[model samples]
Target: MARVDVRLGRRVRDRRAVPLAISLALGLTVAALPVWATAHPAAARIAATTHPSATEPVGEPGGGVPTADPTDTGPVPTEAPTTTAPPPEATPPAGTTEPAPTTTAPQEPAPTTAAPTTGAPVPSPSVPPVRPSAPAPSPPAPPAGVHVTTDDVTLTAAYWNAPSTVATLRVTVTNTGATPARIRLAYTLPAGLTDAGTGGCAGAGGGEHRCGEWTSAPGARFSTLLRVRVSGDAWRRMPLSGSVRVTATAPGAPGPATDDEGFAVLFPPGPPVPGITLDAEEVSFDIGGGSSGLAVRLGNSGRVDAEGRIEVVLPAGVTVPAPPPGCAPAGTDRTRCSLGTVAAGRTAELRLPVSATPEAQLRAPLSGAVLGQLDPRGGRARQLRMSFRITAAAALATPMVSPPAPTGSQGVLAAGTPSVGDGRGGSARRTAILLIAVSTLLVVFALALATISLRRRLAVPSAGPPASPKP
Candidate 1:
């Protein structure tokens, strides 16, 4: 009976083994399902703690949903990574710095397992520590010295010093500079000097045109007017009180002592109470063809006779014909036409023809003015000024020298004579005076005193002797 029972138990065990084998295989298949699904995004997670061996099966069929390929490019599930980075760059010199090197590569980090490789280089941060030191400063300047001073002025002239003639202002300057310096002396024509500043006395006469002399210096030049405001110290002693503008530079020098010597200036004196007037405001004429004549007419136009020179500035192409025989040119600009002297309330003409010189006649503007007098010493100048232009009247026809006209007597006529009795009357009067003088002296006996006075001093001049005004 025991033998039969053992056989039966073996048969039963064999039958149970079939179900167990199937269940074991099923478990492995279920485990593999999770592993495959985990590889895909669309699956339930398997516990990471589960051992790989646990999923191994003794036996089972080999299938579930098909597994995805390993090389698929779909996004993978992952945690945000840990990384090391460089710091921010420091500010650099604006417009002044060079660019960094570009081809260089970042170096590989040092290896924990081994020494770092030389494949990539690490760029050092561009931060500069303490900036370079600053630059140095500049030095100081020098100092100034003490100032010098000027002196008072005096004047001397023909009109003022001459016996019969009117005054001719001669300005004299007395300066006080230890070092040589110029003393600028100015003379303002007392407002009512003349109607025309430069008339007879203003111009030339008796071989002396420019005749004013300074106190000491003889032939000194006049400076141009300076329009700058006078310094406070200088303004205190202005001649005419108000503000005066002049063109003259008084140079200064530094010295211990003041100089009391300066220059003297000779110029036409100012007009009388009112002023001097011209025959016309300006003298202008045109020279075209034929006879072109320029007459500078004058009128004492005031109370006294005006003495001054008239100037006509012609274009370079034109000139004045030389005077015919008899009349000699009085002054500068030889071509200058002349009126020996124009009397008060009288008229004069200076004829300069357009054909004065043989040249082309052109239509052009004459740009120049007439300055009656040329003395602008220190203060403002009372210059008789005028400007004008001439338009050509006709075309040139012929060029020839024309003969000058003849003149008549200069003074009044006698009762019997038509123009003038030859000046024999003066000689007759002098002879009568000599006869009377001899008769009176013969009776009075004063002739001896006269002879003695003449013999006493014939050479040395008196203390107040006049200084002649000629070079």
Candidate 2:
């Protein structure tokens, strides 16, 4: 009975084990179907994503392909900058950096660099910052050696020869400036004087007259010193001077007509001896300093052409030209001015300039003597000395004089002719001059005489009215 019961149990166990095995197998198979389903779906999705559709592209293994998504750009949408700034310090290598050859600013994306303007801001294309550079410095000033200065000038004169026949003048100049300058000296002689030498100075053709009575010597012209009165080519030291013009720059600017010229005080009249004479024998000028010229007129009181010489004495601080360049002197004194012959019946005139410290004080009187060489005798030289006060500024002109009538010892005058001629006599013209001179003198003398007479008249008492007419 035990064996049989055991067999029945075994059969039941076997039945249960078979069914369980079968059920387990079926469940494993069902789970395996899910894995296969998941694989197939995943494969289909990967294929779809691999190739981009109209809306999107697939993700690649290494890099994602661009997608044409409505929300995203085909690639990535990029935004450009509104403006770019240049590097504050853009120092390129010395050789590599070039000065912007063109004045125009580099053609920026936008084009507008027209600037007289300063403190401007410029925009540039996007670029990396450059290193800052140092600015260039300015050049230096001139060295201490170059300079310019005035030439201290000295002048001396003398009158010599019969009847003051010759006038001699000498001048010297000294340098005071730094730097060796190629010096030149020039000056125009006062009118009425011809040139004394040649090759040394410039010349003007004023010495000769048109009446054909005067002849200009070969060297006649304006005065100037072509080169310094130096011995050799070497530069002479400053403070050196000779009978020459002390020069600086020329008169005018550098050009074709430019010349080495200077100004001087002369017998300021042009084409001199335009037939003139003083109303009287002499006129006095009491001129001070700072005067540029003196004016005067003369009337023709006689019949023949007349001529005369003039002399001037400068007060302290005043100056008279030394032997001026291109001037031929009639006498040794540089101040002596000569006017050619004036017709006997005509009067002549002139304006004279006096040199002085721009502002000098003139005290001593200015005396002028007009004498006609009426004869070879000693008394024939007529001289009139007058007094004048030099004014700070020049005044009106001097009145002209005509020749006086025939008078004084009669004989040929300086012109080497008869003392008196037909029509109104040259002597008459002289007389008129003499009368004016004498009258002027007499006026002064009369004043003194009158003062004395008045003093005496006042001092002498009446004799009690002659005792009342003797009652």
Candidate 3:
């Protein structure tokens, strides 16, 4: 009985040992699954590939394993959890035949997480990038070629006559540049002067005279003349002065070029006599011994006919190198000119050549005198004082030349006219008046003495007769 019981205990111990070994093998396989999946990724991919969806759990339906929730906010698995079946010798039933080997498509690589960015996000390909706009272009510059110039700009006004006086303005326009140009000239007369509407110049109002446009070829010149009438009241304002401007223009040319010229009509104060008036225009001379003319004008302002000689006394530091026709030098600084019988309302002009010495001052008051008479009777002579200034040599371009006097009444003294003595005729007339007064006084004293003697003789004769009678 003891032997039999020992044998039965040994059998029971063996059966219990089999179950312990099986539990140990299952624990080992479950722990080693993660390592096998990491090492053999291709073989372990059967769970993800064969499953209907990658998120499905690796267990049978209704098993204790949980189903993945699509709406769950849990952390996503970086790598798909790979699961594989246990080895055939460990988990398959003894009767079940091994499943035929299956084929699977290759798996694509998992997308990687991009690095954290700190700068602005890049624009999408569908939208275009914004670019800076370009700037506007500048205007073109003017051409350098076409140009116009002006020369010989002169303004002439009659110095003698005031009423019915005409002033002529002449200018020469030239295209000095290489290219031809279009030029337009306009004249602006000073105040109190009006356009005469002559010389093909039309009045554009406002004392402005406009000459129609003219085309000038290269190196060619065009001359324009404008005559304006001077009112008598305007002439009364002696030394009336102003400037004339001419503007030139052309196509593709720069701003217009202007030519400005200054002009003046000068006159001096004269004696109260209404028959004749005297005037002297301003003179200019170069500092280095240039010569200019002194224009002396004599006008007959009265309705009566008259004539006389004119004498000019120059200031110190000035000399007359050459005297005008019908004029003679009376002294170093004096010139005597004669004018024939001046008819009513007539005038004459005499231009004397004058030169300035090195000592002559510029812009200084140069005082002098002019002696003459309009009355035929000699005693009516009067002396007119005048003054002027000397300017830069370029102040005046050309000396003024006046129209000649009428025939038989020229500025030259005709034959048979009494000579006008040295300018001291006024003193001589005073001396003759004193002599006549002395002679009249002497005659009156003689008459008074004779009358007294006659009275005394008569009284004495009566007394002598009475004494004889008494004797």
Candidate 4:
């Protein structure tokens, strides 16, 4: 009997154990379904293997037990009410003790339909800050050392003569720096002067008359020669002056360097055509109180006519009467003659009468000078001189007379009678002798007649006179 009972209890325990193992296997498969679906493409097949349809009853063909189905998803429902009965308790097999059961909380299931969307919000991608770039700088300028100057500057004269003359103006440009430079040279001509087309210069600038441009190397020099000429009546009123200017700079320099120089002009005197030549004869004077005469001749020796005033200066201790026409007093002891244009090769005469005062001495010299000019505003004048003698008053007053004239029958003066065609002048003398003879005969006849009358008177004597003769 004990054996039969133990066999039956073993059969029951085996049945319960198989059902509980089946339920636990189903739960674990369901829990693993979501992970399997995510890692594989056959998610529907995995769901079918895990949960059973709710409409299907557990242990349909066997004793009361739960089982898995492949189709529907609703909870299984109980059949129509039959009887209200409690479940029966199970008994442990002999020789073994039953273990106490443990209570466990239910766990939430993982989603199998859709993926979760609300994980930690993804942070925006990190980025760094930005900044702006700067522009490049410019290069620096060149250094300074250049010069401009002249050559033989002392040769630049301040004054000139004649109507025109030639002059040299030499300009030199020097570079006293390490780098090359450029220079501009120029000059200004005074009125009535021109630049004689003779220079080593490049052509003039566009708007500047005498300026030019050039380029030079380091420590190099350049030169230009200018020939200047004078013209017109420039020397008549005043002289003309010219000037030069030089400007220097580097290739890209900002400002310029400059220098200046100047020159002047003048004129010389003219030639003689307009010259005068004078001549005079020697003169003599009585020492104390007497008069004398002088004659002077003037010749125009120049090619051009002589005009302006001609003067004659006299010494002291001499007296002069009224001067000839066209002559007047010109300062002390001087006489001036107004000569209007005396033609070339022509001659003119001046007659002057002079006297010596009581203070005059014998052998005293009488001197005279002739000063003449052509144009009062132009050329230099000419001068000439003559000398004579003075004599004592006791000398014969023999008047200095000119030669006798021809027979004009004006006045008969014996001392000035000129020799005629023949020598016949005795008739006037014979007539004077005849008158003297007649007067002598009259005196003799009168004396003889008086003698005859006396003889007659004696022959007829008186009566008483004859006797008295004896006594």
lDDT of each: 0.28, 0.29, 0.46, 0.42
Most accurate candidate by TM-score: 3
Best lDDT among the predictions, by candidate number: 3
lDDT of 4 by residue, 32-97 (tens): 444333322232333333333323333324432111111213232111111111122144233322
Cα error, residue 141 of model 3, in Å, equals 18
Candidate 3 lDDT for residue 310 = 78
Name the regions of candidate 1 deviating beyond 4 angstroms: 1-274, 279-288, 306-308, 324-334, 356-360, 367-383, 393-471
Could you give candidate 1's per-residue lDDT for residues 17-58 as a string of tens digits?
A: 544554554554454444333232211112121212212331
What CA RMSD would candidate 2 show?
Answer: 55.3
As a TM-score, model 4 comes out at: 0.26
- Report each candidate's C-alpha RMSD, comma-separated, in the order given: 61.9, 55.3, 65.1, 86.1
User: Model 4 misses residue 319 by how many Å?
Assistant: 2.4
Query: Candidate 2 regions off by >4 Å?
Result: 1-290, 296-300, 322-334, 362-385, 393-471
- The residue ranges of model 3 lying beyond 4 angstroms of the native Cα positions read 1-162, 199-206, 266-282, 285-471
Residue-by-residue lDDT tens digits, candidate 2, 1-471? 112234446445655554555455455445444443333233234434433332231233344212112222122212111111222223433422221211222123222211111232343568765667644322221111111111212111211111211222222221212211122333333333344432223343433111000011111111112121211211111111111223322111121111111222111111122233342222233433334444434443444444544444334444444423222334422244554554556544555554555323222222222222211122232222211233332222222543322222322222322322242344454554454445445455545555555565466553332232333
Where does candidate 3 have its weakest 10-residue lDDT segment?
77-86
Total clashes, candidate 2?
Answer: 80
TM-scores for all candidates: the values are 0.21, 0.19, 0.31, 0.26
